[model samples]
Target: MVSLPEELQAREAAARQRMEELQAEAAELAVRLERARADLSRWEITRETVVQVLAELSAAEAVPEVVARDASDPKDAPAPHGIGVMAVPPWREGLVAGVLPDVYRDIVEIVADAPGPLQAKQIVPRIRLEATTAKIEGTRGKLKRLVERGWLDEDTPGRFTLARHYGDTGRVNSR
Candidate 1:
């Protein structure tokens, strides 16, 4: 029993109020979504850090045993093939590629063959690994390890080359 124009105005007011409520709810949800994304980013970083630390721990624990066994019986020592337990010994004056695990040796050999320093992405294809983000990052880690162990040098950041150049006579020359 209201006038038609008055009823239309009342309905419009209600619709506008409902729209404001929905807008407020949407704003709140957007804030929550942003917070969740931040939390997910932190958790992803934490997981990656934990996995790297655990791998280092496992490598550290296994090193002494590999050393002892290799020292006791050189020939009887397990063939260094996989990356898991096959430790990369620190480079020495007389040490050769034979000392490294197969994967590491492949890296060293590839670097040695290259005309100049190479990036992890460049090395990935030579090593027969897919040129994916994960593969490149993993190779970068191995390249860093080689740098740390004195097997490779990082003269410029993110580029790797051999620490010592191998001569035609199979002798190592300081680079």
Candidate 2:
């Protein structure tokens, strides 16, 4: 008993209402997404803090043991007059390699093999990459990051050497 125009108008009004409902649902979803992003950011910060604390604790624990062992064993002590006669074993190359990106590993390899500290320019050719300025700069950045992470030492300005703990010999210290 409904007229045609009335039926069409009713359908149009229902569609409009449905559209409004969908818009509300979308707004709610947007708010949830924002909350999830904030939560993820918070979790990332917490994880970083936990990791740092654990590392510091582990290092602190290691020092006392090393010191005690060295004090008990005369052979373990450093040579007289501040000289270190024993070649301290290098850190595990595989361990270092596993954490590094390919470019960074390559840079480490190049530096480790060098007879002396190398400048960024000197390292580029040994890596066998196209010697573009960008590549050189990127290599420099990786070197700086490695130094920051204690993987390498800046022996002189703009030149780098492997840290004492990462000696070229690839031998792991028995201690």
Candidate 3:
């Protein structure tokens, strides 16, 4: 007959072995998650750029040929408005969230609605993105860009909040 202590020891050893295996698997998954995140970030940026370019071209096409010829200097051309065309403009008096690109506007709305400053990881799930390292990093980049543009304030590293001067509820003509 087997001793109880002996059986217990064997069970403990088995459990430990299983734990070690799971830990190894977890580490491998972490590596894969990182790679996937990088790819996702690249694709997201590329898609946004392409969308913006197409919108610009479409807007330019809509202009009357005479108007197009009149604005020989691109500087004199009216800036494209709506959808992907406008990058986050610097926040100013009377500026509104509607002016931002869709993703940026969503980020701002999320931050504005939050009770306090939030990290990119916290905001990622709110934006309906999977809470992955790549998503967090991509969100962090957008938050930083908003800060640079004066649309958001990063009071602490990695934590974002709406700029004080930016009105979370104000109405402005979206362009």
Candidate 4:
């Protein structure tokens, strides 16, 4: 379908003949694809220094009472050497169960351990914290916020009930 000038047409036919003659000299590059991939794969850094740095970084993610609202109870609180905020209460067993961070785990423990509803004032002294966790007001906010999040039931104006058992508050499963 493609047309050319008569002189160009003859030149094109000659070019095709040359291409066919040279075909045996040129090899397909399909095998180079995997070789290039293998070369790229070799650039990966598996050095111990890089791995050690990453390990230290992962260790650094510890939860504090103020920032992470982490819910780590004293019992499960890991040694403070690592990055990840202490052991955040591993997200509880069921679906409605929250993914409590290390700080919240402590709050959950404190709330659940108490005999009954506890006021923020009452809970202030009970929380076991070191210099790393800052002060009481931050912890109070964590507790109150947990109540609002349905992790605990607030009784009076400021008292809280541990909602670890009766989760999802009063919502009934109609099924």
* lDDT (Cα atoms) of all candidates against the true structure: 0.76, 0.66, 0.76, 0.55
**What digit string (tens of lDDT, one per residue) describes model 1 on residues 36-143?**
976775676577667755665565565555335545776765545333443677887667776565567889888888889999999989988667666688789999
Tell me the spans in candidate 4 whose CA falls farther than 4 Å from its real position: 1-98, 129-134, 164-175
RMSD of each candidate?
Answer: 9.0, 12.4, 6.5, 19.2
In what order do the candidates fall by TM-score, top score first?
A: 3, 1, 2, 4
Error of 4 at 6 (Å): 99
Model 1: weakest 10-residue lDDT segment is 166-175
- What are the per-residue Cα lDDT tens digits for candidate 4 across 1-175? 5466877989989999999867644444545766665555444323433664554446355323433433566645554556354223333325232345444655666776777888766665665532122234556677767776656777676778776553444321212
Clash list (residue pairs), candidate 1: none
Error of 2 at 23 (Å): 66
Residue pairs in clash, model 3: none
TM-score of each: 0.49, 0.41, 0.56, 0.36
Q: Residue 25 error for model 1, in Å?
A: 29
Per candidate, the number of residue pairs that clash is 0, 0, 0, 23
Clashes of 4: 23
Candidate closest to the true structure, highest TM-score:
3
List model 3 lDDT by residue over 76-108, tens digit each: 665555333335667877767775667788888
Choose 1 or 2, whichever is better by lDDT: 1
lDDT of model 2 at residue 80? 49
